[model samples]
Target: MRLEQALRSGRHLSTADPTEAELLIVNTCGFIDASKDESISVIRDLDSSRRKGQQLYVVGCLTEIAEAEVRATIPNVDATFGAEQWDAVAASVGPASANFDIPQPEFTNIKQPSAYLKISDGCDRPCTFCIIPTIKGAMHSDTVSRLIAEAKAHARDGTRELVLVAQDSTAYGEDQGDREGLATLLEQLSEAVPDLPWIRLMYAYPGRVTRLLAETMARLPNVVPYLDMPLQHASPSVLRRMKRPTVNKSRESINHIRKAIPDVVLRSTFIVGFPGETDSEFEELLTFIEEQRFDHIGAFTYSAQKGTPAATLLEQVPEAVKIERYGRLMELAQSISHDQNREMIGQEMKVLVESAEPTTSADGSPVVIGRTYRDAPEVDGLAFVKGEFKPGSMVDVRVEGALPYDLLCSPLDFHKP
Candidate 1:
């Protein structure tokens, strides 16, 4: 989004084809080893294929973590900037067009119904497996007033759903020592932008989720009952090695949240094959998953990121073991997901229409693709609706059929409330 803002400020037109553009901005992610490899591949590919006079700038987390490596290895990159250096990037690209004024707080180029509002940046946590703190620094939150203004702007610009994001969402305002910061912000945003249909929260730290926060979510009609708390592992021993809160604490937190919001859709990610994770520990994680019955689960094999404490831990799990564990975990998660989806059959849900393209179903009838409140924008499943609707419109959908991850629905009616 910063890149988009920079381009708009410079009055540069976006091109779908990289070959057609004079300058290509490669914003990269360095969250994991896999992401880093992918970013490198993209940079190399773009550099190799660029026409004469084309400029390539690499920016973001990858640059922050490995600027020296990027500059040394990718000689075609004209410059590299960290995630927070948008001003330098703008300066390198020249000034804003005389006629164009940069929009404040909101991106005018964004036309999606769902938007991510990053209320805070960076992290202060010492999770042994994470390198985010090293790359992005400590937690810094935007003021409540500023975030509220941004939320209102998003609503005015056709965004119906807002997903509040941060490295540790529940830890918002702790840097400034306000314990009830996130709760206060949510209340203000709800009142300020009543038009936004769904306000979802992600990347919440379990320890930081105060009772007031949960209560605020339950009270706010727009704040959808969904929580994305990434509990990296379930075994107490593994969690200890990861420098995370105990598994008992996690269980207690989940139980409290479930009791507070009975219909809450829980989403989480887990890391399999953490160092020294025995078969018994893995079984413990599996049992926890079975007991929790989360609406969505993402399982990943632990990547031994460089410069992290876990990288040098004893008894590193083998690659084959990691792969096997990942498969087993995902297979179990799929069964749970299937059961959860099947339970929603014959239920009515409010679906945010994503795409209304002309496509015939198996019976040669047209259908639309949308998502329910339970599904986050890109990471989760979609709802296929048999109806004529405009993109970004919300409508009522009756689940006629269910797959393990998606829903086949018939449009009931257009939803106003």
Candidate 2:
């Protein structure tokens, strides 16, 4: 999105098709093997299909970590830029054509009901299995004033839900010497965008969900009580190897947050197969998930990224074992997720309508897809409500049924909670 804004600001023509553009920019991700493979495949496919004069430039996380690898492996790449180099990319494409036969079209901002407002970039924590800090460097947060301005802009642009995202959202203001920076920022944003219906937070690190932050969330009407904290693993031995906080500390943080926000919807992520992960350790993770009973859970198989310390760790779990463990973890998560959805069957919740589907229910009611406050965009489940709703409007709904990962809901009379 920042890249698109940069090009638009430079008066460059934006084409949805790469074939129509003179310069083909491919933003790549090199976070894990799967992401890296997808990025390389995309670059390869585009390079092979692009016109003779079209320049292919690679940028983003992949380039930051492996510019030489990308350049060497794909000899056709014209240039490469690391992450956060949007201006450089725009400049490289040169200024937009002036006084052309066809004048450049005005910038068209897509209307989205929910907007992810990135409060900070990069990471500072030293986790052995991760490569984020290596790729994006240390953490740095945006100023509260700047973030409030951004939040207000999002509100004016018809964004019903503003999601705060960062490498570590709970660590928002440590770089600026502010201990309760995130709590303070939330207060300011809530005051700044009073009309914004929902403010969601994602990617909070464990052991950092301070009491003050939880209280601020509980106090604010707009800020939803949803926390996405990724506890890679639960085993104390595995956590020690990963350089993460102790399990007891993470449990304390979770308890504190839940106590403050009693109705909080908890979302978490876990890594299934880590180096030297024994059956007992994996069972411990499953036990932790069962005990937590998180509303939403995302699990991933461990990937050994180059230059990460975990890649060189002894007793790396076999590929077959990783796959097996990943399946088991997700199976448990699915059952837990189903149970969580079931609890909402009789609850009245507000849903931000995303789109209307062509399909209808058994009774022939039109289906509108949406997300509840419990679900974040993309990475979480959706609500399929029986009604015709404006795409960007928020509506109250009573959940009538539950699916493994979604809810079946019907429109309810507006009660203005």
Candidate 3:
């Protein structure tokens, strides 16, 4: 978002091909070793492919973590800026065109049914495996008024859904000493943009998911009954080492959320093969997955990030062991997800159309592709709706079939605005 805002004043335009553009800006993610490697690969590929006149610049988390190293390794890069150095980036790129007007905060060129509103940046939690806090700095939330303004702007721009995002969403307002900050912000947004049908929350800290926040979700008509709390592991021993909430506490928190929103679609992420994670610990996590029966689960092999404390920890799980655990965890998660999806076979859902491709249905008609409230943009599953509808149209769909991660739906009615 900052990059987009900074570029708004420039006469230059964005292009997908580096060779065609005069300047290319790569926003890199360095959250883990895997992401860092991917970033390096992209930079190298772009550098190799670019024409002589094309300039390359690197920014974001990776730059923050190792600007000097990036400059040293990638000598072709014209400049590098840290994660928070938007002003410096703009200065390096030159001033915006005189005719340019500052774009609305929520405006974007991307076409989608939903938009993301980042309410806060950075993190304060001491999760040993994470480099976010070190890279992005301490937690800082946008004012409630500012967030409401952005939400209203997005609504004006035809955004049907808004996804509130932050490093720890539930911890909003705590830095400013207001315990009910997120709840208050939600209330304001609901009133300010009643036309937006769906308002989703992501990256909520389990420990900070207060009763009031859950109740706010329950009471708000626009707020979807979905929570994405990334529980790294279920073993108390592993949780303690990672500096996360204990297993018992996390379970209590989940129970509280479920109680508040009985039909809530609970989504969580788990990391397997953290340093010193035992076979017993893995079993505990697997058992928790079975018992919890989360509507959606994402599991990944732990990556020992270079600067994080976990990288230096003893008894680091072998790569083969991590991969094995990841596979087994995903298999179990898929079974649970399939069962959960199957139960919704006869239900009616409101699906927001995302894209429509020309394809023949069972009876030889065309259909559109979309997602229901249960699915978040990009990360979760999609719903294949059998109907003719434009992207961003919300339609009522009757569940016809189920896959492990996606749903097959027959359109009952189109709700085009």
lDDT of 3 by residue, 265-346 (tens): 9999999999999999999999999999999998779988778898899999999999999999999999999999999998
- By summed lDDT, which 10 consecutive residues of candidate 1 come out lowest? 100-109
Ranked by lDDT, top first: 2, 1, 3
Q: Which model scores highest in lDDT?
A: 2
The list of candidate 2 runs beyond 4 A from truth reads: 13-22, 44-55, 68-76, 98-108, 356-365, 413-417
What are the per-model C-alpha RMSD values against the true structure? Answer: 2.8, 3.3, 2.9
TM-score of 1: 0.93
Ranked by TM-score from best down, the candidates are 1, 3, 2
lDDT of 1 at 379: 82
Evaluate model 2: give its lDDT. 0.87
Top TM-score hit:
1
Model 2 Cα lDDT, one tens digit per residue, 79-174: 999999999998988767755443322323556798888999999999998899988889999888777877777777788998999989988999
TM-score for candidate 2? 0.91
* Whole-model lDDT values for every prediction: 0.86, 0.87, 0.86
